[model samples]
Target: MTDLTELGVAAIRDGVAAGSFTAVEVATAFNANVAAAQAALNAFIVATPDKALDAAAKTDKARAANKPLGKLGGVPIGMKDLFATAGTQTTAASHILEGFIPPYESTVSQKLWDAGAGMLGKLNLDQFAMGSSNETSYFGNVVSPWRRNDGGNASLAPGGSSGGSSSAVSARLCPAATGTDTGGSIRQPAAFTGISGIKPTYGRCSRWGIVAFASSLDQAGPMARDVRDCAIMLEAMAGFDAKDSTSLDMAVPAWEAGLSPDMRGKKVGIPREYRMDGMDADVAKSWDDGIAWLKDAGAEVVDINLPHTRYALPAYYIIAPAEASSNLARYDGVRYGLRDLPEGAGLQDMYAATRAAGFGAEVKRRILIGTYVLSAGFYDAYYTQAQKVRALIARDFEQAFQQCDVILAPTAPSAAFALGDKTADPLSMYLNDVFAVPASLAGLPAMSVPAGLNREGLPLGLQIIGRPFDEQGVLNAGLAIESRAGFTAKPERWW
Candidate 1:
């Protein structure tokens, strides 16, 4: 029998189908794992064990009766708190939304449930998804399961925004988890935790009911222990949702269908611009190894240039914050979520007091910057220019796609860093996402797969960027790299 903790979603489903394990048993094991890992990693804001077990029991009943089993079947997954779950506290890791419970579920969460996936509970995240390091969370920072290669007391950081999901998945608390990426939140955390994750093209997944940061940039995706599991969860999570105006009407593709090893004529691009200075030697080696693996897998590796890469980071920072300012304006004292009651305070004063007391420093910084950029005097200079630059960045990827099936680069500059290492310097923390932001700007599909381990014994991942709606290409390349890299064990101490 496959070890419940170690099995992927696909393996777990197969086991359930073959009567090797029941959904109730599988859910129980994962719930236990969540409790164990939560003490060390601080990954979850809530763990709904009773609800998960009940759902899993229903799945087991259906399977035993030879009734229809949904795509996800008995798989248990973690949800990022940003996605509203009915009756659950959806705080978004900020005090502003404390005790806020939605009456309805997010479209993505509903889809997962409809597909028979069990929810382990809401995971922690950077406050308002505003920071790159998990330290900004009001719930406390998430520690990476991986430690320094040399025996040390270094508390490693699992990357931010989706840090809890990444940490939980890496720690084997759940088979896979849901994450939202506005500007590299999902991919960066996946890279830091040494797991596999994918951010589908914008609109590929529904945004309805998910707390908004940047409406245009925010997208929900899956993070898992491996590429195939990521593929499995993504297939169930993506679909057309008429409720979300921006949701795409495109048919959800079979993400796992074309994952063949035959890459004989596939053209893979190595973007020359991503090779940044000061990149760690181990990361560089991992990139080279990934390219070698692709070439050995019969894919043609070619150098491609995305000339606008230099402008992407700046443009994304401007655009995402500008959108955030508008989206977060709903959090006044009169609205849903937390409200501050100050003695003798009028309407405006009450609103100010509530926001001041609720929002964290990083969230406030983003809102301030966002408001400043979108202000009348600065609008044309900052927000307008950033929009134009975003267009240019998209065009760069469009041109690159004509020459290659997918583009490859290092997922991050390095593996997980020590907690508190970059928290004091916000700019340094933002720089950590330099490599993963360009794709988000272009609204392209991208994924991170473990390529190799650094000298510190921490894992490094390679990113694969695909054309719009071309997730199959990205996953195929990732599967190929995954087979070659073959580094499948979690940190020994974590186990």
Candidate 2:
């Protein structure tokens, strides 16, 4: 039998349903792996092996009783810390949120539970999901399992916000994990860790319980080892939610059953704007390889222009932070999270002290930027202008999609950089999302598939952006890349 930890979500689902292996065994194996790697990887913010085993036991009992299992029955997964788990701590990797546990489960996590997925633990992420690198996590930076081909022992970052989710799935600590994408949070990290992840079109998944970053752009999705696994998990995670007004009111599409590697008649758009100055040679080559793979799968490649591409990053920074300032205002010490009340301090003094003490540097920076843009005089000049540019960016995609079914581009400008390398320069760090933010601003469905390795043996990912409600087309394209890329490279386990 193959390693239980190494199996994909679909395989695990089928195996548990067939009684070929008990769910308890699967949970136990992954629990041991998580325990062993916790120190080196720093992927999980908290370990919930007991919860996992309890869920697994229920799955095995269901099998014994000849009852139907849910879509994720007996499968274990990591919950991103941003999601509010009923009993577990749901910190968004920030001191402000530390020790805050929700009495209610997030809609997406609850759906996974109802579908039979076991909770392994809450995974780490950047504070308020702000940083490109995982270094800003309050717990500590998550170390990627991959090393450079030159055999340098330096630790690399698992691209952030969803860094821990990517690290755990790639290291085989869990079959799949939940991730929220506000601006490349899911896709960028998945690319860095050599896995598959998709950010469904905005409103496809409920935002009811996930911590808010940008109300308009945040979306929940699946991160898994392969496209099929991501498809299966996504079906269970997405659907209409009355609790969230943003959630679509339609039934979730059956993406798993409809998975196909055929792209014979599909038109894949190669955006001319993604070829930026100083793009890494390896990244360029991988994008070229992705084009060839899609062509081999029979997709007709067409060059399309998105004229507003340059404005996406600037617009996103402004809009996301503006929303962040509003959403995060509730964290003032008067409520549940950490409060810094000085002796005999007044309400205003306490609020200021708590925020100053609780928030990290990066989170503070974003909040300040957000507040400034939304300020009285500057609001029209900065925030309003950015919103207008955002509309233009969406229009650019709308126009481009007329000539093509989906767009293909590199997931990031370069491979995973060494930890601490980009921490000093905030601008450089923000550039990591250059290729990913455009689709995000447009509220489009996008996915990242591991394409191939760079010259120094780092993995490179190719992104596919699809039109609204076209996740099936996006997954189909990803499957085509997965079949051709044959990207089975794994980080050598030094831990």
Candidate 3:
């Protein structure tokens, strides 16, 4: 018998339905693995073993009774802490919401439940999903399982925002997890941890009940060990929801069933602007290899220019923070989450005290930047200009897609760096999302597939960006890379 934790979403579903193993047995094994790693990995903010077991039992019963099982039947997964789960603490890795449990479940989580997926637990993440290294998490940093090959033994960062999701799936705590991408939270972490994650076109997954970061940019997707598993989990996680105004009314496509690695007659665009100055040699080599792999799969590789690419990072910083400033304003002491009322202090004083005590340093920094950019004198200069640049970036993609079906690029500029390497310099930290933000701004689907190992033995990922509503194209491209690259590497389980 194989180790149950090694099986991903699709394998577990088929295995459970075929009676090869009970869903409970799979859940129990993963639950133990999660428990064993919790102290070292800190991947999960809260562990709900009972919830997993309970859901598995139901799945097993459904199978025994010959009833129809949902798409995610018998699959247990990690929930990024940003999504509101009933009876579970849904902190965005912020002290402000440390114990805030939503009475209602988020639309995405409910969809997963309806599709028979069980909750493993809420995952740890950057405080308010603000940082690139997961260091800003109130629960503490999510240490990547990968260490450098040089025998340094320095604990590496599992990329931020979705760091815990990346770490857990990479560590085999769960087969898959949910992650929200606002400026590369999903793709960058997947690159760092040697896993697969996809951020579908904007509005593909509902934003309702998920903790707001940047309203327009925050889109949820799946993180898993392979492209097919991501496709399967994504099928279950995405759908139109009336609760969210931005929700796509379009029907959810059968991404898993539609999974095809064949890229015959497909055109893969290589953005000339992606070749950065001072790029890591290993990362550059990986990009080269990805191009060769797509070619091997019969994709025509052509260089395309996205002239606005240079402005993407700056525009993202402005737009995302501006929206975040408005979205996070609800966390005042007057309502839910945290309250720190001073003795005999008025509302204004209490608001100041509570916010000061509640938010983390990075969260505060972003809020201030957000507030400043959206200020009276600077709104047109920063926010409005950024919005215009965003439109230009989208136009660039639209024009590029005319010549190519999908675009290939490096997921991040470099491999997993030592934790805290860029914490002192905010600009360096923000640069981590340089490759990923352009796609997020265009509201396009992008995926990160493990490409190969860097010289230091850390995994590097290749990204596939597709036209809007073409996740299938991105997944197929990812599969082409996944097969040709033969990226079977997982982090050595030091934790």
Candidate 4:
């Protein structure tokens, strides 16, 4: 093997379990890669080498004592900064919570640790997980490890909210990383970076200590280089938590053990609404390729229409921001990270000043949009209507699911675009999630698996969405595509 860092979650766990290599060896190799690549990739906001080493020590001792290893034994992964890890500064990449370290760990992170995973560090993300690109991070934007073959060598966006998680996994800095999807944050970034990520059904993973973006839409999952690794990591991350009111009280399934790519007797649906005019040629071709792949896997392909899909993006924009506005109100100058108290000001002035100074441009924009939509005069005209659209979108998926086991679509409108390509145009940036938001609105389990490379040598991905609590079906569809697509291209290590 070239390096321990090249191993994925399952490989690393089995390797450590069998005494082929020590957990410390794997952790050390990944820690070095993370340190060496930080300047160029900006993937991590903080690096916790000691945390990894400490976890490895415990694992090594457990093995020596013949103690049973957990599901993710010996793997070190990135914790997206949105999760509140005990004693680790958990910023949602926002200045408002710059140095705020929670006394308690997030339920998801705790679950990972319980399953023998170690935290390499907290990863960077769009500030408050708000933007489509990683540019909104207060720490700085994360650059993809990829560069186009067109010779300009202009940096590309790694995709947002979960950009740091995607970049780190793609670069082999970590085997897999935690990612939360509010509106395509996990799947879109996974598609952009040529990796696999799943956003489980809403409430599948507890939202207890995750920095809230959209209360009902945000769901945590895993990002890895391939489908099986994502399955393994997700199995470790998902479970019930009483602390979160929205947490599913049902038992977590054995998803990793249940994974299979065989699609015999499975019906795959191609959403007719997704084949819109002006779709990129590369994206359209990849969708076609995905259809053929599922067919080759012995699955039957059929046409399905999600009539409300055209309204998904608009509805998402309204609902997510509106929820974010309500969730973010607790970050006042009184209790937390950034307290911008002017010498002669009262509480309300401090609240205004702190928010103005602490929030990024995109965050403020969303907050204003949210506040405006939730206003007394416009609430029914905007937020209420958006919720109704969301319900329609969900019903559309429910009806479509009756005709098929899973739905296939393109992950994004295009492959990874240049860093500044849509920065000046917010609407253009929002369109990147057009193909991804419908599933989020339905609160379904969805995934993105790398399909192939575009003409520019950047990757394109195919999305598989399944019914609620049906992540196994989504992962299986993704596996069928992963095996056939043979997406072995990794970003060249420029850092």
Whole-structure CA lDDT of model 2 = 0.95
- What TM-score against the true fold does each predicted structure earn? 0.98, 0.99, 0.99, 0.99
Residues 1-495 of candidate 3 have per-residue lDDT tens digits of: 999998988899999989999999999999999999999999999999999999999999999999999999999999999999999988899988878989999999999999999998999999999989899998999999888989898989999889999999999999999999999999999999999999999999999999999999999999999999999988988999999999999999988889888999999999999998898999999999999999999989999999999999999999988888898898888768889998999999988998999999888988999999999999999999999999999999999999999999999999988987999999999999999999999999999999999889999999999999999999999999999998888777777
lDDT of 1 at 382: 98
Residue 331 error, candidate 1, Å: 0.4
Q: What are the lDDT scores of the predictions, listed in order? A: 0.90, 0.95, 0.94, 0.93
Q: Distance from true position, residue 325, model 3, in Å?
A: 0.7
Candidates 1 and 3 compared: the better one by TM-score is 3
Model 1's C-alpha root-mean-square deviation from the true structure amounts to: 1.1
Clashes of 4: 0
Candidate 2 at 146: error in angstroms? 0.5
lDDT of 4: 0.93
Per-residue error (Å), model 3, residue 315? 0.8
User: In model 3, where is the ten-residue run with the lowest total lDDT?
Assistant: 486-495
Deviating ranges (above 4 Å) for candidate 3: none
Candidate 2 local lDDT, 314-345, one digit each (tens): 99999999999999999997768999999999
TM-score of 2: 0.99
